[model samples]
Target: MKTLISGGTVVSLDPSIGDLARGDVLVDNGLITEVAAHIDAPDAEVIDACDRIVMPGFVDNHRHAWQTAFRGIGSDWTFPQWAAAMHGTVKAHYTPEDVYIGTLLGRLEALHSGVTTMLDWYHVAQTHEHEDAAIDALTDAPGRSVFCLGAGWGGGDSVDDDIRRVRARLSGGGRIDLALGMRGPGATGIDTAAREVKLADELGLRISLHIEAPGVITALHEHGLLRDTLTGVHANGIGEDELRLLADAGGSLSISPDVELKMGFGAPMTGVALAAGLRPTLSIDDVPSVGGDMFSTMRTAFAAQRGIDGGLRSRDLLDFATVDAAASMGLRDRTGSLTPGKDADIVLLRTDDVTIFPVTDPAASIVSHGHPGLVDTVLAAGRVVKRDGALVGVDLPALRTRLLASRDRIAEAAGVPLDGTWRPQP
Candidate 1:
């Protein structure tokens, strides 16, 4: 199928093609076939991009999609409090059905907000059934994703078998890719981290780690686990040497500024990552405590960085969520920019919206004033997942019912109220 997006302000994010004040894009067979000021495709579906900002869809490099049902549950909690509530209490009550619903809803929300590709750091695999449920949700969703499978709080007894099963089942081929989410040295012991790294390497899967401490990077490097496929998430307190090691090893970082600030994870590592020659990607992390929109993530990152480094550009933050993000997830060759031969994961933001009206600088308008509601159309892999500000093939009312039921059941099982005020027992 061929689709032509015409007459939009194109922010291609590809330096070679550059941004076009008024341009067109052509997608053929799920790959971008052409990106130019004008394209002549006589037999193609025409999408009018007038008064819109056409760009590659945001790529969220890190997110916990399995916690969608727990949104706003930890809004006022610190990191430790959140960990206790989620890992200690709530996750213990989540059934496979709950995992399925939450994963599906989270991925759907990402797509609705112009995030076409996501790296779901799904640490909710309590059982093999739970892992399967998470994969099923991503497979059912329209957007592209990397399912970074990991054992949640109480699910590590048979994690190796479960991981192997998931790899065998879903690694064949599809939009949903497989990755290993490892609890690195800081969270787990060095021996456990080494074993997980070895398992991931043996399985030929990329590894995602939550870098919470300073020496975790050094530990991984010493174990020969700090490679190109290792993505460090929320690298808060790591120093220059650690950053240098990551840069030298070609490892990437995923920073969730909103969650970091809200949960007191310290100042964001955006400036430090950039200084160390790492094009860090932005992420929504867990939407349970904050919103799931990439626009808010980008805006928050931009503001935070600007406060630290006055010379920060809005376009830089935009890149953190777009092209740079795709690269960090090892998806640059596939769907970062609107480059010919790349997958057509694209978004169209309504320039005529009240908040974005009279768009002067396209990048500035998007990074500063844009919101999820301004997303007009979203196409993932040449398929229209969202058009005219509505998601395709999604029954919101049905999803809401399932989500509410799952939340209620999980809350009840956890012995907590449904109003999200649950705390871990002393």
Candidate 2:
């Protein structure tokens, strides 16, 4: 099968290919075959890309997709307060059905927003059935995903075995990949974290974890567990030494600027990461407490980093969500850039949209003024996931009903009110 996206401004993100003001992207058998000024494939389905910006789809490095149903539940709460409300109270009430609904809904939102690849930090897999439900949701979603199976809230004793079980069940490769999510030394202490890291290493699985302090990275280094496959999430409080250590170890960092700013994770480490010779990826973190799309994340990261230190470009912000993000997830060779041999994970934004009209520079316009509503079409692995400004084959009304019902049931069961407002105790 062949598809030709014709006559658009192509932002390949590949230094070799560069950006094409007017070009066509040719996809054959789920891979981009060519990107040039003209493509003359006679039997291909032609997608008109005129007056649009065609670029590689955004890759979100970290997100708690299971928290989708609880959106806006902790808008006014701090990190500790939100953690208490969510992990301490709400997570206990989620059924396997809730996990499925949340995961599917979140991935669908990613597709609608031109994010074809996402790293889902799913921590709601309390039971074996819950794990299966989460995996099923990822499988059903029409995009590439890395599901980082977590050690549930408060941690789990059998987390190693749980990871092994998940690996054995979903062993093969496809759009969905498996990773281990850990709480690191802060929550689990060095000894337990070391054991978990050893187990993941033996299983040959990539590891993702939260790093609120420099001590966590020190612990990983002490245990000799810091490597390229280790992705440190929220490296907000880490100092220069820690950042250099992480960069030297070839480990990636995921910075969620909006969540970090709102929840007091300190300023995002974008400038610090860059100065430390690291290209950190951007993420949405928890949608319940922050915005859920990459556009907001990119904009927030760019502005926040600039406020910390100037000399950042709109292209740099876009890279944090695309090429740099794919590198963080170990997917650079697969789907980051619109290179010829890479997977056809692409997003087409309408330059004619009200918020993004008068496209001066394609990359700048996308990073500075892009929104989910301006995403006109999205293709994942050469398959049309979103087209003509709508997600294909999705019944949004039905999904919304199911999600609302799940949210209500969870709140009622947990004995918590569903009010969106949060008040701090004096």
Candidate 3:
């Protein structure tokens, strides 16, 4: 099927031509066929894009998809305390049903906010049933995702069982891509990291690591596990040398500014990573604390970068949410920019929104004034997932109730009341 987007300000994101005003976009067979001033497709469905900011759909590079059920369950907790409570609960209490509800909520949220593609950094597979439940949730959603499958933090029989499930999922050849999600050197050492990376390489899959500190990469490199297949998350502590090694080794980094700030992980060096020949992208990290909106990540990243280095232009942050973000997800060839022959993952921003009224600059408007509510339309793989800021084909209220019930069960198992916070009194 072919569709033509008529007469809108297209942020083509194509470096060759850049942004165009009063442009036309054409989509055929789930890919952008053309993006020019005036296109003629006689048999295609035409849609008006008047006063819309048509750009590439946002890509959230790193996400804990199962955390959606506990969105507001970790408030007022420090990083250590929050992880102990929230992460521990997932390992001990989350059932297969919990995985299903949590992932569904998270995926639907991404669709609503114009995030067409996501990296589901799933690390809570306690049983084969749990793995099945997580995949079921993603399969039900409209957005695309890479399932970074892993065992629950229990780390013994759980890891072995999760690996078997991962193998089965890969063998099935479904929409889910199999990637290794490790707990890093702190939780698992260099030997374990190498084993996981090797498994991914053998299967031609990419591996994502949580680089909470510089030591994680150092340990991986020391053990000869750092390579193109490895991508680091929260690369805030790495210095110049470590950054170069990552760039040289063809590894990518995802800087989730909001989670980094809230957890006191220190300032993100996204600029420095880019300067060192790495276009380190950004992500929302997890829902609830950071919210599942890439716009929030873009805003926080831009403000943090500028606040640290004194100031920056607006286009700087847009790249983090679009092209740079796609690079982080290893999807530079599939989506990211509204380039011809790429997936038609597009986001139409309602520039006429009151919050962004008196718009000064288009790029600046996105970073400083834009929010999820301003996302007017979203298209993923040539299908309209959201129109006029409403999710299609999903009962959001019912999903929310399921998620809350799952949260209550988890809180009961953890022997704590999840009113609003996960921090237990010391």
Candidate 4:
């Protein structure tokens, strides 16, 4: 199987190859084979990219895909308030089928919006059935994903067994990866955290933790458990010392600027990440609190960082959403760039639209104003998952119906209206 994306402005994101004003990308059997100014391949199927901006698909390193059914539910709440609602009431109402629908909805939406790779920080896998259901939905969807498992609520070493069981169940070497969506030292104390990290090492899996408070990195350092496989999600208030420690240990961060600012998690660490010697990665965090597309992630990180000190450029911010994000998610080699030898995770954004005319700047235009609707073609692992602005092989009506039903059911069970202001219980 072969695909030739001909004559598009390619943002290779690789410094050595550089950006191409007009280039062709060739994909063969799920891998990128050639990228040049022009390619002549009559045997391959040609996709016209004359009026598009061809680039690598976005990578969202941290998102609760299983919470997609609660989209926009806690938009007005603080981090603590949202946590109360989610951990206090809503999650208990989730059924296994609900998890399936939610995961499917999130992954499909991500693909449609040109996010070829995502790390699903699924913390609500309440049961064995729910875990299986979430993984099943993720596999069924058309995108690369990491199923980062977690212990439902409170910190416990009990989830180590769950991770071992689930990891063994998953077939190795595929689009879906298994990781530990851990409570970390923030929720679980250092002793338990040490145990969790050891377990992750034994299983040979990565760990993505919510770094909500200070001392978490310190705890990991004390235990000598920090490693490259550890990724801190939404690292809001950690100071330079913690950042340095993380960077020294080869750790990474996934910052959701939109969620951090709105939920009062403190300013995003985009500028700080750079200062502390770590390449920052952007994420949606959760659709219930922020927009799902990488465009929003890029712009939000840029604006928020600039609002503080004013340094990040559009090209640098674009890297946050693409290559940096892929590296943070531990998927740097498989995807993240239009370079040959990587998977064909690509997106073609239509540049002829009124919002993006003149063709002055590619990276700036994309980072500032690119959106899901502007995405015309998407390929994940050389498969055309989306074409002509619509998702391929997806039953829209059925998926929509399932999503709505799941949302309503969970909301009703929690004694909350699907559409109204949430009132906190005294």
Candidate 5:
């Protein structure tokens, strides 16, 4: 199938193409065929981009997708309180069905918001059934995904079988990749970190570590477990040296400002990561307390970055969401910029929306004024997952019903009633 997105401002993040005031993008099969000023593909399907800001689809570096069922229940939670509640009762009651519902909700919501590629930091695999449910939901979604399999905070048996099963299941050509959702050195000791990282390396899977505190990278590096395939999440409290260490080791950092600042994890590492010569990727982290929208993630990151480094620009943040983000997931060769020969992971944001009508600068408009509502169309792997401002093939009512049932059952089993504003009492 051939599709030509004709005549709009195209912000291809590809340095060669740059941003075109008026451009056209042609997609054949599942890859971008051409990005030029004009493309005369008479037989192809034409998507009018006259009022759209066409760009590469957003890539999220880190997200706890299974927490979608508990959205906003931790709004007033601190790091400690949230850990206790989220990792304690609710997690214990999670069944295979609950994980399936949550993963479906999260992945679908992510697509609606123009996030085509994401790393699901999955850690609720209490049993093989739970693992199956999560991976099944990932395959069911119409987007590029990385299943970062993890053991829960309480620690479980070897995840080798689960990881191997997933790898074998998704071995052939598809949109999903496998990774290790590790606890890292700070949370787990060095010996355990080394052991797990070695296993990931042997299996050829990327490692996504939660850099919970400072010196985590240093400690891991000292143990010779730090590798290029590692991606550190929430390096909020880490120092500049730690950032440099990560960069020197050829690893990437994912800054989730919303979760960090709100959860008292200290300030975002956006500015420092940049200063340390590392292109930091951005993510929503977890939607349990925040919305699963990449626009919100970009905006929060922009605000936090600009506050620390006044010279920060919207295009830089856009790069973090697009190209840099894909690099973090180790899928740069596949997606992340609107370049020819790359996967057609694209998003078309309408510039005619009430808040976006006066599109002065295209990239700036997307980073600053853009919202999920402005996302008029999205194409993942050259397939139209969302078009005309609605998700394709998704039953929202049915999904909501299933989600509610799952939440209710989990809450009941955990003996914790979920209130609209469930918080830690003084």
Candidate 6:
């Protein structure tokens, strides 16, 4: 089947080239068939893209799918408190059913917000049943995802068994990509982290590690573990030397700016990383803590950079959430750019929206004033997952209700009330 998205202002987002104006795109069997002006296909279903800005769908590089059920769990807590409460709650009350519902809800939000792809850092899979439940939920969602399979939360010495079990059950099939989530400095010591990273390498799987605390990248560099397939998540404290090592190794970095600022990890993100040849991406770290809004992520990262460094261009911020982010997830070829032969993972923004009105510049308006409501349509792999800012193929109301009940239960099990607050004593 062929689909034509014609007469839209296309932002190609191709790193090799730049945005295009008054463009048309064609999709055939889920891949972008062609991208240009005045393309003609006789047998194609056409979508009117007039007055819309068609660009690559946002790619969220880091999110906890399990936290979808806990959208407002620690809204009023400090970083430490939030961490403690999240750990306590998830450990006690998150069942496999909860995992399924949460992941489905999270992916639904992604589709609704024009995020065609998400790298779900799901570390709450405590059993085979739990793993299957999460996978089932992702498959149910219309959008694509990278399930970064992980062991139970916190430090562990012997994860090889868990890794093998998850791989045996989940991998060797191409539907959902699997990356091992190597616990970062906050969760594990240097030695344990090295073991997890090496294990991922031995298995020939992509690896993602959190770099919350100091010297995490240095530790990885010392062990020669940084590589093309390794993605460092939330490298808020990484320095120039460490970033150089990351770029040299051909690895990638993802920054969850809102989460970082909320947790007081750092001000702004790794512009230094970009300067040193590493273009850091953006993400919604958790849904409950912060809603799943990639535009918000882009804006926060953009403002933080300019606030810290005096000024930053709008194009750079857009890249952080689009092509650069896709590259960080190793999905640049498939979904980042509005290029021919790529997946039709596209988003259409209404330039005439209130916040976006009087658009001085198209890209500038997107960075400064873009929001989810302005996303008129969203397509993932040529499939219309959302249109008019509402999700399709899923009952969002039911999902929201189910998740709210689960959150209350989780909080009750954690010995806390349903009110949104948390903080660990430092």
lDDT by residue (tens digit), candidate 1, 1-426: 899999999999999999999999999999899999999998999999999999999999899988899898878778888888787788888899999999999999999999999988887656778888888999999989999987664223435776788888986798888888888776667777878888887988888888888888998888887888888999897887788899899989999999999999999998899888898889999977899999999888888888986867988888888888888777889987999999999999999988889899999999989999999999999999899999988999999999999988888887877665566553
**TM-score ranking, best first:** 4, 2, 5, 1, 3, 6
- lDDT of each residue in 1-426, candidate 6, tens digit only: 998998888888875445667878899998987888778987999888887898899888788888887676655555676666666555557788888888888888887888888888887757778888888888888877888877666766567876787677666675577788887655777678778778887887788877776677777778776778888887776677777888899998888888788877777456777776888888888866776888888888888888777566888877878888888777878888888878889888887777788766778888888888898988889988787767766777787889888777776776765543344443
Please list the C-alpha lDDT of all candidates, in the order they appear.
0.88, 0.87, 0.79, 0.87, 0.87, 0.79
lDDT of 4 at 352: 96
On a 0 to 100 scale, what is the lDDT of residue 310 in model 3? Answer: 51
Model 4 compared with the native: what TM-score? Answer: 0.98
Off by over 4 Å in 5: 154-157
lDDT of 5 by residue, 132-213 (tens): 8988899999999888888777353566777787788888957778898887766566777887888899988899888877
List all candidate RMSDs to the true structure: 1.5, 1.4, 2.0, 1.2, 1.4, 2.0
Candidate 2 lands at a TM-score of 0.97
Clashing pairs for model 4 are none
Write one digit per residue (lDDT tens) for candidate 2, span 178-297.
888987878877777888888878987788888887777877887787888888888887887778788899988899999999998899998888888788898998988887888888
What C-alpha lDDT, on a 0 to 100 scale, does residue 380 get in candidate 5? Answer: 96
Error of 4 at 328 (Å): 1.6
lDDT of 5 at 170: 82
Q: lDDT by residue for model 3 over 1-426, one digit each (tens)?
A: 999988878887788768886898999999999999999999999878987888889888788888887776554556776667666545578899998998888888887888898888887756678888888888889867888876555252224346555667667665566677776766776566666777777667777778777777777777777887677888787887888788888898888888888878888877778777777687877765667788778888888887778555677677877787777667888898999989999988887889887656777787888888989888898898888788877887888788889888887777877666346442
- Report the Cα lDDT for candidate 4: 0.87
Off by over 4 Å in 4: none
**Candidate 3: lDDT of 359?**
59
- Those runs of model 3 whose alpha carbons end farther than 4 Å from true positions after fitting are 154-161, 170-174
TM-score of each: 0.97, 0.97, 0.94, 0.98, 0.97, 0.94
